[model samples]
Target: MDNQRSLWAAWAERLRQRFSFILQGQCALCDRPTSQVFCQDCTRRLQACRVQSSVLQIAGLPPLYSWGYYEGALKQSLARLKYGGRPQVAEPLGQWLAQVWLDSGLLERGLVVVPIPLHGDRQQQRGYNQAELIARSFCEVTGMPLRARGLIRTQPTTAQYGLLRLERYQNLSNVFQVGAALQKSPNLKDIVLVDDIFTTGATLKSATETLQQSGFRVVALFTAALSERQIA
Candidate 1:
């Protein structure tokens, strides 16, 4: 009976491996055979391309820190996450952002991770807030608490893509407000605003101003990718 059980276990393991190989798909970036969305080699290369600058200065807003520029593998991965219905991509990407946050030494300040919120209609349409997903994963990896509802989007606005710099700011104006729970939480002070991408600093600036007006200090903006123009 013992020998039979051992043989059966071995056979089951073999079958599981075979099935896993069958199910494993190509890497999202390189098209190489990988069980994960991004293979190990591609992931390392992506990490290597990350921005060495830990501080990004934007007028009237907290400094931003991004993992990499929005291009190549990073851009492709984010596009899939945002528009391709591949929400699972947020995990590894968020982990990378979390690592950046950890290395930046701001984690010692007891900062709360707050993701920029999506309006009810838009969020419902998309079925998920990508920022929230990234923030959740960030907290999981860093062991920091995430205040997912710290901010609320009271109104929906036009998408910022292709909009001029001034237009982007105007579009987001009066769009975000502090959530009631965060308002009532007296202990909450410092925050790290998490977003998927930083384009022109408009969205983050608006969110920062709103939070600051509400008596919270935004320590920094954390994002997965930053546009080339914004990098300068």
Candidate 2:
């Protein structure tokens, strides 16, 4: 029964993907008519923000790969994706991230993509988790397995926008719990966390520690954009 259910779920996902393109209307950034999430001109401008190099060795975090700096078109697109009811925006962004990862020669077997999850209440309010949406498209392009529910946000925290660096860390402490799927298979390792943005790194740090403590090896973090402060 479990195997049958898995097959059904996979079929349903494929069916959804098959028709997802038919729903596209206007570009998320500009209101241009487009079958894609972004228009050609907007996509070109967004690509201009891409970081030439793929990997950045931050002081204490895992190897990070961000598609672009969080500024200009990239920033605006992310804002629309996260706050403006534009879930379709993730499709292209995730594809872009996957392309960069492939081009960087970082492709490897057994690395599971785990999207940073939102708390249940927050996800219910938003109707979707942007990170998970991005990770789904990323896996579609990369063929890497996606553990969409590998981690659960057990506690709801306030928005981290105005908080200081230390405060942000405090906000997310002990917030992530290993989901049941990951708990059932203790051998699953080699996690690559995906998120829409890497800001002060507080959120990723807490999540990485949680996964590490749970015995999973977090190899890298893949994000669509890096905060301007991170670029400096």
Top-lDDT structure, candidate number: 2
- Over the stretch 5-44, how does candidate 1's per-residue lDDT look in tens digits? 9999999999998888778977776767788878999888
**Model 2 Cα lDDT, one tens digit per residue, 114-223:** 99999999898889999999999999999988889999999999999999998999999999998886887676788999999999998889899999998898999999
List where candidate 1 sits over 4 angstroms from the true fold.
1-17, 23-33
Residue 22 in candidate 1 has what lDDT?
A: 75
Q: For residue 58, what is the lDDT in candidate 1?
A: 80
Off by over 4 Å in 2: 1-24
- lDDT values for all models: 0.87, 0.90
* Candidate 2 weakest lDDT stretch, 10 residues: 17-26
Tell me the lDDT of candidate 2.
Answer: 0.90
- The CA lDDT at 175 in model 2 is 97
The C-alpha TM-scores of every prediction are 0.87, 0.87
Which pairs of residues have clashing backbones in candidate 2? Answer: none
